[model samples]
Target: MRQYRHFDNVLLVVFFSHPRYDVNLDYYERTYAEYFPNMVFVGPASREDAGFNHSYDVIVDSYGSAENLTNPEFYQMAGRMAHHMLFTVMKDHPCYHGYLWAPFDTLLNVPRLQQFDQNRFWYHSPFGEYVPNSALESDQDPDLHAPPARISPDPALNLTEDWKGWGPDWCDPHVGLPACLPAFRKAPSSQHRRLASFFENGTERFLGGSSDTLYVPGIHREAFLETLALFLETECFMEIALPTTVHLVVPPSERILFVDHWWIWQPPFNATFVRMKWEEGFEVDTFHTFHWGDAAEGESWRAHPENIEDVRELLQESARRQGVRLPVATSQVTGRSPTASSLLPVDQRQA
Candidate 1:
């Protein structure tokens, strides 16, 4: 095993909505502080409003309505805006090297924070192939609104012509993907600049960019890909089209890594634990992270505190085993002092 270096990078958790059962930001602050005392969490202040601000290290803000509406282009732009913001914060700030942008509803069981190379842009899912789960009838069922599929270099479609109006002659194919687009923008406002440049550079390279190279998150933030938002817009014919479907025609040569469980209806590649299975001392190292799925049935992480504890424990244990000194627990950790009895169980105490 490789000896892990002390990570100087900051972790950023981005959430668009505050789930009903979601743990207070303070809880996350305190918990992560134990392992990554330097980590930060960024999210919207409330689910109903569109506002942006930073709390401790967590960011609270709303996705502007214009960007988050049902329109496909708006959604693609919104994702672009979020990634641009992340790049700006990480690149501009002197305190951190890289950040993690996780949806608020996710249940994390990340036992150890791996040292991801900043040279490449890494994402939980690469090609966006959403394999169907047991709940779904089949993987190719177009009617099923399954989780976003992982990006596959080789789709079942042709690669010569632009699939949905995007390719190498237009611009970098990777720029179309939401997770990979931020890496391509020159600045946080690069989207606007790129739009302007598009006028000057012409639609050839501007719209037909290639996304062949593998993007290692911290290492290559600028590599582009057709984002989920982009796909939805083009395939579903949403209100706005972002012109990111070039990847569907010309997939990357490198294999993209995806979060094991992107679609709930499909069985995960190696899922050791499912939703609400943390209390059984279930090991967290089995998977990097687990998606809680849509917010319809109140099954998200916001509704489960025990799962949060499970996530915290897994990360802490990973840190301990790695010989990293955990941060001291303080009200600053949770934004409140610990109660006597709640602190009785050392393991149960706030991170």
Candidate 2:
């Protein structure tokens, strides 16, 4: 991603490891060191190398670590747990303005890079206006993480009222969560528009949508961390839990839905517009996720991406959106033919 000049401004790049590979974090750090100097790896395995990070690890968010990888509930909620764990590692290193969470196979639209530029990352987030001066000005260059307001809560606990109290004393004000998420049941067999958890009040609706890729800032850091607990408590998948939890936390006075969802079919998108991330999307933070999961029971014709071709096609379209073609980004390092899985992510290729 550093191939693009805009990505050069990214202070730190973190790779959240899946539980299966958490045992050998140093190997990942040593192997990918050439890509970026400030890059680091976070996972359950890093627990073994305490010298590599803070003394503790994020076991709760590691999602079953190696024990419950096969458990569907634990597996689905694990994605959010990864975000929580990443937040834990990033809080100490306040050089970054915010964080972007995308799949290993994901690609940034060449044009979309401007929105995520270091100067504009906070503005493009959900609560852009809520950003504090400490995050923006740093006029005196004070310790952004260890502000005087921070109460030094026990970091050992996985779930808490405000995890690290990022909002209570750090931000402008703490706008409490919504009374409850709102949505209606769409009956069984539907992809969305249904209840995520078995609530006590029998509310059959929820704020549900796609969450494959997202960007968040310090304002909601702990709220994002508590999402896994909410998911498990609600007994729903990440899709429902994430969106509902996110919207629920937005301050009512500033709540707005920037996300866009789609129902797509076909793979390795043959045409320019097929399965596009919305032909005319939100100009500033336009983002759409192609459902990479299995087709619904009756919708057998839907294109289920089995390999990386669909992802490469997505990147090709991302380039086209900027009136350009996919560049030979890997050639700079490999010095080999650009055809050598240039678009295929290293992790997937190795897997």
Candidate 3:
């Protein structure tokens, strides 16, 4: 077991990469060194480190097989591997205060990086309506139900009536990919119908109204997954295991905040939100990290260098406010190249 030296509330940014996106890592390192000096980057050891001493708080051992949509089991294994990596970090570095795990393409916008708060998990609510233990197994559980409020399913669509029910806090009017909505309405699978009903009903009922949008910020991680798993087992709803619900996690407390309007599958929407963040100056104040999901897409941070620069400036400013200097490095460090092993065949890797 590797012993990691203790640090005050470290920000752990996670990523898995291929050869083509190595440049993304290079730029990320440079930006981190220049702008956010207080933070440390942890990643895998490379072949080039033959005799060289590289400093990293943690290193992921196996790269695991790549994911493919066509093959369900392979894809599921890949996701499991990703989750394992996160769990490894949590287990090994319990002393560290908070973690911000994201794909490599994620960018930092503000200079003052908000340290993670362990007590509260931050992420964006997938369902626009906030429902309490709706995520939990039963409404009777005191741990899940808190209060009641009127929630509208669609914030985009104006509904005059608000329905009262038990639900989580933090409902926003952001439904993912419009195309997905039709599928839910047509086939009406439990997952699909739940999504459609959320849109149609406009309000989620539960105790303790929406937690607050700022609470849930980013990708679904270990804590949130565990919570969901517990909820599904209790409710006997196996569909929650589907990949679509990956982002649906509990609402975060005000102390722990999540920057919003970013998703893994959607690109144009994320770009638009980023632009909005830049315009409003909100990005400078609150956000520390920006995830550009799916390196293969056109909306990737790699494709939008200008946006990356905007984020870089934010990180620099944040560093200055925090009174910390990022480690400066001149030599270029490239991430591992994509290989046959790295690229698990679509048939073998899809889950």
Q: Pick the candidate with the highest TM-score.
A: 1
**Predicted candidate 3 versus true structure: per-residue lDDT over 1-351, tens digit per residue:** 111222223344444432223344445554443322223333444423211323232254444424354753322223223433444444444333455555454544332234434445443333322222221244233223222223224423322233222121112111122222322233214433333443445342211111211222233344444543333332111122222232233332132233332333444423354445444433322222344323455333244445445555444444554455543223223333222111333234211
lDDT value, candidate 2, whole model: 0.34
Q: Model 3: which ten-residue window has the lowest total lDDT? A: 166-175
Note the Cα lDDT for every prediction shown.
0.33, 0.34, 0.34
Stretches of candidate 1 above 4 Å error?
A: 1-6, 17-24, 45-81, 112-120, 124-303, 313-351
lDDT by residue (131-150, candidate 2, tens digit) is: 22211233223322111111
From the highest TM-score down, the ranking of the candidates is: 1, 3, 2
lDDT of 1 by residue, 3-38 (tens): 223433434433333322134443444444443333
Cα deviation in Å at residue 277, candidate 3? 3.9
TM-score of each: 0.43, 0.41, 0.41
Clash statistics: count for each candidate? 72, 3, 48
265 Cα displacement, candidate 2 (Å): 9.5
